[model samples]
Target chain A: MDRSKLHSVIALDMVEFEFNGTPHKSPPQTTVAGLLESLGIEYRFCAVEVNEEILPKAQYSIYEVKPGDRIEVVTLVGGG
Target chain B: MSTNIHRLSVAGKLLESRVIVGTGKYETLDVMRESLDASGTSCVTVAVRREKLYDRDGKNLLDYIDLKRYTLLPNTAGCFNAKDAVRVARMGREILSDLGNPGADWVKLEVLGDTKTLLPDPVATLEACQRLVEDGFKVLCYTSDCPIMAVRLKSAGAASVMPAASPIGSGQGILNPNNLKIILEYLKSDDPDYPVIIDAGVGTASDVAEVFELGADGVLLNTAIAHARDPIMMASAVRNSAIAGRQAYLAGRIPKRLYAMASSPEEGVITSRPW
Candidate 1:
């Protein structure tokens, strides 16, 4: 197999998604928990929403990230 | 006088303090914490926002707040429509539930109409309130000082109807007491124990006192205490005012009169009127 062809095959395995309104790329089949772990956020302190639907904490480990998914990680802040 | 313990009860939850303060607009987090302590508030409002990434420091608002001391009342402050408000409310519930807080099942629902005055959108507010209530939430609906809207919200199953005294953070201080009075009368007409709280536009201690004296069950404010020249001192004043106003309301103020009646008998008056 050609070396350039092998590199292109690996690139197709990655998924493009939006994390907190910014473009991000991750490997296919990455779970929300895995993504949070890579981001270094303690999942227990924050809430997550994927594609405008709230993802319960129980589903973080089971739900897989897909291409074009919008993810938001939110935490408590000062407000009235 | 017989001493009786008074507490604010809403949707089966009882709070020792009637004054609810917010966690925003403070000059510093340390000052905000101190001001909260000084305010003698048992419940504080917080907002939900996207987490700030790339920061090695792990400090957050929960670090400054003693969760054991104050109940975290999550609010949908910036949402301008019903859909966004409901989503935010759900997110808030999820975070608080995970943390094992008592406030996890409730939300301070605010659907704003615009950004200029920060006034609440009555239509969206009612829509969101009903949705939250049906979803097993003890919704504390924030609305304008419109008695009609207040009554509508209560009928939609709001735990508490919080009417704004003025615009949010305007510091105008109870612009229309008559409307607030009407809200109190209608909401508490049959259900006398219904909690109608004044939510915003408190300028100083006097504003807090007036809210209580007007028979409101409680007052929720933020900028009045947080943005004060001396936030800690302002918090203390607000604390005392809440107590004083509640007492005054219980005491029952005398009726207003255009003509004054002499306290001493007219026969006992020795000096003639200057007029």
Candidate 2:
């Protein structure tokens, strides 16, 4: 395949999503745990929200990310 | 009676310390950890927020906080509305429950009406309290020192009603003592043991003492200790002040009178000559 054709095919397989308000690109069907692993975060230490809904830790390994999904990974922070 | 034995109980959870410190505003995580230890609080407040990713420093707050020692009272500090507060409450619960902490079933709920004041919205706070209670959460609701709002929160099933001494982080300290007194009377009138915590606006150790002196069940503060010149020393001071204040409250002071009452016996008047 030509170089440009190969690049277009690869782009089709990638998914664009939002992570903590920043845009991110990941492969299709990337699970929450997979995304966290990519970010060097431990799934057990934080809570994940997909499209503003909390994704249970039990579902982190099973839940798949879709394009345009807004994923928020949250943990404890210092506050009054 | 020693204040140490008189634990503060809220929703069946007994906290050994009457002072609940917030783990916030310290210069560093090390200071926060040491301050928490110095404060001698059995519970500490923490907020839930988006994690910082891809940073060179990979430290987490949990690393500093010993779960076995401190019950994490997760707070929805930045949430402005009921829906967002409820959502954050659930997330907090989820995180703690996964870690097998007892604080999983409870949350410190704050729904601010305005950003500048950081004062809770009465309507939103009440609504969020009810929803959280319905969800099996023991909500510790934070609000202004409005006695009526405190009553409303109690009626809505909050485990503890935390009234602000002043606007959050302002450090002005107990702006309305009369309203707080009324809150204590109204809340404890029926259930004497219902916990009423004084949260926010504590400027120094004396502010904490004043809170317990007013007969509050407990005092929750952050900036007073965390932002002090010496946080650990301030924590210790606040801790001792809480004990001293509670002891003084139980000891009871003499009633206020227009004329001065001499501490010494009037019969021994040889050294007492008043013009």
Off by over 4 Å in 2: B1-6, B268-275
Report chain A TM-scores, every model: 0.87, 0.91
Looking only at chain A, give the TM-score of model 1 against the true structure: 0.87
TM-score, cand. 2: 0.96
Superposed by TM-score, candidate 1 places the C-alpha of residue B170 at a distance from the truth, in angstroms, of 0.4
- TM-score of each candidate? 0.93, 0.96
RMSD to the true structure for each prediction, in A, is 2.4, 1.8
Deviation from truth (RMSD, Å), model 1: 2.4
Candidate 2 chain A: 10-residue stretch with minimal lDDT: A39-48
**Whole-model lDDT per candidate:** 0.92, 0.90
The residue-level lDDT of candidate 2 at B156 comes to 96
Worst 10 residues of 1 chain B by lDDT: B1-10
- Candidate 2: which docking quality band? high
Clash pairs detected, candidate 1 = none
- Across A1-80, the per-residue lDDT of candidate 1 in tens digits comes to 79999888878998999999999988889999999999988887799999999898889999999999999999999999
What tens-digit string does per-residue lDDT give for candidate 2 at B93-133? Answer: 88888788779888999999999889899999999999999
